[model samples]
Target chain A: MAALLPITHLLWDTWRGNLTVNPLQDWTFRTGDWALRLLVASLACTPIATIFGFKQASSVRRALGLYGFGYAVVHFFIFIGVDYRFAFDLIWDDLATKRYILVGLVALLIFMPLAITSTRAWMKRLGRQWKQLHKLTYIAVPLAVVHYIWLVKADLRDPLLYATIVAVLLLLRLPWVRTQISKLKYRRVFQKL
Target chain B: MAPKKTIMKIYSSEITPEQTYYAQSQSRRQFFKTAGLVASGALLSACAPSTPSTVDPAPTAIKPEKPVTAGQTDELGDAITQYDAISNYNNFYEFTTDKQGVAQMSAGFVSSPWKVQVGGLVNNPKTFDIDDLRKIAPIERIYRMRCVEAWSMVIPWSGFTLSNLLKQVDPKSEAKYVRFETLLDSNRFPGQRDRSFPWPYTEGLRLDEAMHDLTLLATGIYGKPLLPQNGAPIRLVVPWKYGFKSIKSIVKIDLVAEQPTSLWMKSGPSEYGFYSNVNPEVSHPRWSQSSERRIGEMARRRTLLFNGYADQVASLYAGMDLRKNY
Candidate 1:
């Protein structure tokens, strides 16, 4: 429910004519920003569960990833459909020349298959290979972050802060770091007892 | 009450003759050409400094006309952007990097009784009161302002040509460039405290470019004194270049031989260059600049070369490669 709040607010504000001077740009940024934020949140779920001994956090990981993917779809659609109006010739020039555009497109392309295979049926059919395919999250998330960093003209604070959070989350995923976190959680539980 | 066939024939006769329509278009084009010549002539005359003997000698504010109606448009027939949008949507990084926040952040800023120090490689160095500066040459110009972020606005700016300001303290023969510096108060401008940006935003222009008739030292927008967020008291307005080239809230003007590295250039040398002209062909490293969404307009229009000031400024960079310069 909280994940849907951004889109809901976006729609409400847009309908009310409360967007900034440039609504299309505002929509583009808002959708893209929410997509990045949700992806980061999704990535944090597993590590958060291990570190804090909250197993429920792990359950919503798939849902969060799907929501992130949904937002990414909207962001991409806004860029090519509404904003560019399916002007593939202009978009092609953008993809060929603009580093941010290329990076963002690559990130979205990686998310497509991950989103498709997220279902239980595909997971069961793929069996052992399912986890390996999903691990592409490692590449996709960082590319998304790079896409953001590249797009901002200056004032890297917002993007860099996101990059740091992502780095910490990625570090926590390391086998050694996960073992230490689990150990710490056990120690805390034992002390409580 | 006429029969259907007769009615159709009557409607067809009412259609405008193709020849007449073509002639009307030709006359309209001719009218625009004449208007262009007249507007440029008026601008040139307005740029000449008002001598002490010919005009009001005492220091006084250069007041611009009241808010323009929707019907009043720029020479290019672009509608003047609404003052509300212009005021609220600002890119003054001194207050904040967020465009929407600058207005509120700079609410309490003090721009009155401002002093602009002019010196360096000049025959005479002096500090001018803002009122005196305004009296030098007062004119209202509607210019298309294009940002490097691929957004644009048609702004009605009121101020004097920069040439009039430089004329007071004559530049020495050796002076090759003009440098402008913004206020550096961290308390007033919260964004200054951020170490990420080198504070006291600085920008420069070649002496010739600075002296161009199109180059204005804008003091007002929409015929009202500038709001703090819009670089109150004084700001540079170079229509041919990207918005960043027009540094805001200026405190110092120095005539120097060496090219001064603008804050943008210093921060991102590879991405930003000295001459940040509005050229669609020269795309930024991060994004395409070929198209820009003018404020209030949904569809992105193809970006024009020099923001459609190519006729006046093209000769300035006749031989140089803009791609390399940019």
Candidate 2:
């Protein structure tokens, strides 16, 4: 429901002509924005589970990852179809000439294998190898962020916000950092009692 | 009596051409007068709808303007961009970064009580009232405006040649460049608060470029005085160069011997240049300049050198390397 809200709002906005002067650009930007937000959200699950002992965090992890990938697909489709008019010459030129677009494409490719093997059936079949394969998300997540950072002109606020969120989430993955956060919370509860 | 036909004829005779003329006279310009009401109909994200929900039925005290000398041209057959599209889709960053919001912000602005300071390296330094500057016999020119961001528009602007104005000021022999500054008013123009760019946006042109016949200090468009968001009172309009070269809400004019660096050049020198002439061969460091998406149109058209004014302005840069300067 959360993942679909942005597209739903955009559909209403686009239909009502309530978007920016360049609606096409705004539509593409908003969709990609949600995709990054959810991708980073999915990564935050592991840290939440370690620090807060939230058992349910793991349940939503796969769903969030899948939702992010879905939006990324839509974002790429908008760029090529509406923005570029599916012109092969322009697409070819963009891939070669624009570094950011190339980076975005590579990031998408990295996430594809992980998405394909996301189901429990494929995960159990691959066994321990699944754990190693899923580690690619760490690389893919940062690459997606880089793609967005490069895509923007001057305003770095949006991209920087995400970069900082992803940084904090990554830092929490450290055993010492997670133990520190856990101890802080435990101390707060003890003081209350 | 003559039944249905007679009644229809009688009603048509009563309303007729005089009613149409009366309506025209009662309004300043069809668009500017109703601009405050625009937001109620359509809204864009960056800009508030400048139009009020209810329009004033009566016209203000502003008098009818004299028609500018219409310079005959072989029409490019390009459709005049829709008035709303031209006005709504703007980069008047002084109001806000979002082009849509300026319309609302500018409707409250008083452009009539305006003055332009022209001094610097000139023999005659003068500050003309907005009304007096409008008096210097005008001309109509339809020019294509190509933005650095790969969007384009065709505008019919009303103004006399910039050379005519420059001549009146009489630039001194040492003056090789002409620099312009936008009005500095943080109270009205919120964009000044943005530390990302230097305040009171500045732009410059070579003295020769400023003196070109095609260069105009546009005062109006669409047979009406320019709307505030559209750079009311007076603004520079260099049709051949990128649109940023044609600065808006101009307050001061300075002539200098050295090439004056502009706002964009200061922000990202690699991306913007001192000479921002439209050249297809040289792309902006960030995006392709080969094609531009016309604001209301779908397909992007290939951009032309000097925005297709090469025959007139090409010789101005004949010997210089465009790529280096670009």
Candidate 3:
């Protein structure tokens, strides 16, 4: 958090003059994009840890999850505090009428349980069920992308790029990739079979 | 040399001693008293409510001789006043796209020294100064201005009918269209330097529409000389059209035989039509125009066709297909 100040200040100064996008919208989009990227990064950690045979990579999962939540919180606050001016009626109307808003809210709601149970105590309590519950991120991520695509009016280029990145990350989890990994395993049980 | 130096030193010492003594005695007392009085005066002024004299007076120089008639001042005076403030503070994108930026930057415009050049297909090619144009004729009409963005405002504008002004210009037999140009000054208007919009903002109307009684060459709003933000010096006010059709800070009025290209229409033809009327049924591809929030209304409300002036200006487009033209 302390290290992020300089980068945040640099972004603020750079966008002070540009009026093509409003400052609030720019901040929301950047934060939301960063959250989506962090979610993809967290998903990559499990795959990377398994491939390299490193136990240390698994420990960073909690930090990555918290970072994604932090960005989501920033994005949520910006929408409520600045964009809607904390008006409940307007927010209610947006949530009801706007498809993108509804999708985003649902994604956030799904992530809330995962984020709350990210701690070691909750993990120890839930034990086997914890991993199953955290898998909801895979669903949450695609919903987030859909929320973004529906929000944009005409420009699909940025959203398309995000979709492509997400697709590649999800493809790494396919059965073919898992089968290749199994063939390369050093365990003798495979040879006996 | 020793005698002269000693005399000069004695003179400087004498002046310093006398000044120090005065500062230590009467001057210090006087200074403290004056400071105390000033502080108390400031305290008293801060405690008092601002009276009329203390408040900045509304610009009195441009007040119209004829007061607002009873009929014109309807039950919506408060709403009209709020609309006046919003409309007068506008940065109609045609002049400059930035809403608040244009207000401050347009101060450098020399409105009084300006002239409108009327020529092209007109029988008499003549330039009229601001005063000459003001004296031609004056009419006060309250009309609703609806923006392409779906915000609306009801403004009481003081101006001569565009038809009356056109009569003075005397259109030639071949004249079929009228094009308007806003003054271009990059130094005065920083928005002019912005490439988001093309320079020398232009709008056009058909000759018949230009000559319509509802079309006005406005000089004032709320019975006062227009502020720079509201297109001071001169602006066009076409009541039935979307606000963009009413060009601002006009410098040239050209009557032409061919249809002139408008700025927005040239940029995005499908989004902005040449005949940009205030038709709620005709929605812009980007957003619905089925409703508009009046500037000061507590809640967003439905927009009226022709901005509720169908009785006055609907006949102009009676036989034509509005959807196709739109």
The models' CA-based lDDT, in order, is: 0.84, 0.78, 0.69
Give TM-scores for every candidate, taking all chains together and pairing residue i with residue i.
0.83, 0.82, 0.58
Ranking by DockQ: 1, 2, 3
Task: In angstroms, give how far residue B283 of model 2 lies from its true place.
Answer: 2.7
Worst 10 residues of 1 chain B by lDDT: B57-66
Which one wins on DockQ?
1
Question: Which docking band does candidate 3 fall into?
Answer: incorrect
Model 2: runs farther than 4 Å from truth?
A: A183-193, B1-74
- Ranking 1 against 2 by lDDT, winner: 1
Best by lDDT: 1
Better of 1 and 2 by TM-score: 1
Q: In model 3, where do residues sit more than 4 Å from their true spots?
A: A1-193, B1-78, B81-89, B93-97
Which residue ranges in model 1 land beyond 4 Å of their true spot? A183-193, B1-71
The model with the greatest TM-score is: 1
DockQ of each: 0.61, 0.23, 0.11
Between candidates 1 and 2, name the one with more favorable DockQ: 1
Ranking by TM-score: 1, 2, 3
Clashes of 1: 0
